[model samples]
Target: PTFGEWVKYGLPFVPVMALVVGLYFYFAFRRRIQVKSLNISTLVRQASRKIGPMTRKEYITAAVLILLIVLWVTCSDRFGMGGPVILCIVLLNIFRILRWQDISKIQWEVVALYASACAMGKGLEATGAALYLADRFVAILPDFMHSGTGLAMATSLFTGIATNFMSDGATVSAIGPITVPMAIISQTSPLMVGLATAFASSFAHMFIIGTPNNAIAYTMAKDPLTGEQLVTLGDFFKHGFCILILSFLVMWLWVFLGYWRWMGFINGSVA
Candidate 1:
């Protein structure tokens, strides 16, 4: 099913699920309040129950994070938040926000893995690997199907599938320049390829190594970059495979089922 159809069909049920969860939490909190052992009676208990215990360093870190976030939101056109978050983490290590032990707690390997992948993507783009493939596909698309909705769908799907191996940022950055021109050549909207790249990059998370989140999670138990973690290659792929497939299906639906153009583009006309 298209993502739009799925969302439309699923929306009514989501609120019901939300209510059930709310009720569950409400009763659970009530029951906890009634229990003397867990009740907020003792000073020690009150102190221990604090959510985020802010130490001197933690306070500084919090301040920095808030400042960074504010600047990021305000200056989004001028500066990106991702770089700031990364820099903040690095500073946390440098300034001894916690300690060597705390710094060690951060999974540096996963960072390296993601960084390496991004670099690899740059290499691929610079070497014309992505463009070569995109051009080949564009050349082969028949005249009848070259510029139609079907062609757009095909291009989107192809980019999505290929991006399973290529990281999303890389996929978009690497393929954007190439595919936009190809779309022009094929008489299709460049936005089609751009949207496809975005979706496909997100869709790449099907493979454990495809996304930083998956890598970081695995690196918590094992280093993905150095292959020291407990999670095996097979294990990562096994879990990631199903999720990626579902993501791809949903995203493709979002594109083909009129959600993309309906939400924007072409004078707000529905697909």
Candidate 2:
């Protein structure tokens, strides 16, 4: 599902997210009081002066990206996101906008990592490992099995914790089949469980290598200009743990508020 669907399904979390962000900024500002803050106008002026206008190639690249986004949003059902992406790349190659050398230079290792993770997830499902795990998990959580809120919270917590150690894709792939069926068995909405599990998978900030985005951010911390490691492992764990906790609380609140009920995602008690 797209981000819009996530928003629609997760509307109850909106207020929780807002509160979390507000508190984050409030704390951040308090911590920054000791540092010399740059004037916003001066910073903007300096940034504007340093940056040049986009070139023709840059504009073309931006347009292509926008087009791809539009296709992914509008034509996903008909063509799928991958089809449009592949088509865009093929067109770019055919038009000489991107060279084979440029493609070769792309980080294939990251791509391979994701592909392998997905394959492993599929393998786990195909081998009944996911089912075995899910059955055991459900059996242990007999109390939560009869309640939609409990199930959602449990799934979110499980996926969130798992994603900290494994890639998000792999975590979801392994847990999704299990949680979805568990939700059904409990008479809860499978859609809610699935979405909750998927969203929780994105909370993989505790470990730098847990997700590709985290890995990319960690790599970027090693500045090419200064060769400085801007972000440390301690920095990730310190903040990531808090964020994970807050995320779990927000998810719990969202489900407890019956917002999913308002969205027609769940009705009555799963019990």
Candidate 3:
């Protein structure tokens, strides 16, 4: 069972992980180089310079990630899985590998955002506000679709809005729990509703501090070809809006068309 679960969740890591393992052994044995400490301050200084941004390997890895993102965005309709999100950590690691000499560039500040977002989201969930809101929304749902697509869409949209102000993981964690029962009560597949929630939450990257992953990436690229670490919240918003819109559309289509029947949302049962 444990192995099966790993197989299920770990499929996304296969190729990239294999390369990482290979690189690890190669450095450990062939280069005879000692593993140094993760030095964030030095890396931060170095990355903020023009020639200090990336190494050859870092450039290659980032290129691969960008290619994968393009492929995933173009092919997600047929692939049925969101590829960019899965590959994000790997892409982030490219910066780590390039700045092996300086660990400070890892940006511990962003980790705080990740932790706090989750905590805030949990606090919201504990307050039962998500449940109360979900219940009210379901009660007022129009006669559009008895299967609860409207409710799911609204839930996802609300979740997205909350994520912009709070943390994406926190938003999902807080409201996601309540959505399950509401979805089931409306005769919607809890799974499809869950997917919508997940996708919408990921759209939180639209803001600078909304998602730590985005913040980390932005910090690392502060001295990109643009030569500055002065990116404001608006700068990120401008870049993220289109992607956010696209993600919502993808979730809506995938749920309503592909997973709707699978989630039993076509049924008229309300319990």
Candidate 4:
């Protein structure tokens, strides 16, 4: 979504998720359970050592990053995804913020993997395999699940499960076919189901290779002191599953309370 569209439909989403996640952290901190084991004060001290004050180069880098974010959010409709990134690269190079050596040090394989995942999502959409599978999947839903609440639950369940098998982008692409028919079946707005599917697709909780974010993080992250893998499959399934459940609950709560309609994501009454 572009800037205006995002303000209209996405503004409500942020606070809801923030509230839920914030409360979770707050209570978890209060319990002091499942929240702490390692002392990160050393790492925090290490990171803050040289970052005491923003130097000229740091100021320039910060400005460039802010500009890049602005261009990304505001001009994405005109420039698409690659333009802002490429422009940011050029700006960074011109400012001596990023050098050719730094660029070359990047793991090209990771970029290739991300690009391939995007291509796979597009290919699935173009070849109609996603549509076919989506159709068959919906056909199997019980008659009782052909209503608004049931369909929302089904969409969340299917999306959460599917995202664990592929990237979030691919899950959304694969869900495109399901949304329209789901709207018809459930007598809700197509936008409602589509947005729900898009939001739900981020619950890629079971596998490190599930989404590009998971893969990139899994590959690049390390335990600061031990140099051990920071995120394992077990961690993904354990903590991530709780996050997925919480997210689903939040989404369901909004749907049940007609918050989606309040946010203009749905029009007319949900039949």
Best by lDDT: 2
Range of the 10 consecutive residues with the lowest summed lDDT in candidate 3: 1-10
Error of 3 at 81 (Å): 19
**lDDT of model 1, residue 144:** 48
lDDT of 1 by residue, 1-271 (tens): 2333334433443354345446645664575565555544686767777855657887888888886766565654455546666767777777777467865789897667556766765776688775676678777877644664555556666666666675666666655656655666665666555555554556554565556677777668765587675766676566456555555455545444445555443311223
Better of 1 and 2 by TM-score: 2
Model 3 misses residue 115 by how many Å? 8.2
Residue pairs clashing in model 1 are 168-201, 222-229, 223-229
Give the Å error, residue 114, model 2.
2.2
lDDT-wise, the better of 1 and 2 is: 2
RMSD of each candidate relative to the true structure: 10.0, 3.6, 15.5, 4.8
lDDT, model 1, position 53:
64
Winning candidate number (TM-score):
2
Steric collisions counted per model: 3, 0, 5, 0
Better of 3 and 4 by lDDT: 4
Select the stronger candidate by lDDT from 2 and 3: 2
108-148, model 3: which lDDT tens digit per residue?
87677667766765665678765676676677766663246
Winner on lDDT between 1 and 4 is 4
Q: After superposition, how far is residue 32 of candidate 1 from its true place, in Å?
A: 29
Relative to the unseen true structure, what is the C-alpha lDDT of residue 37 in candidate 4, on a scale of 0 to 100?
A: 62
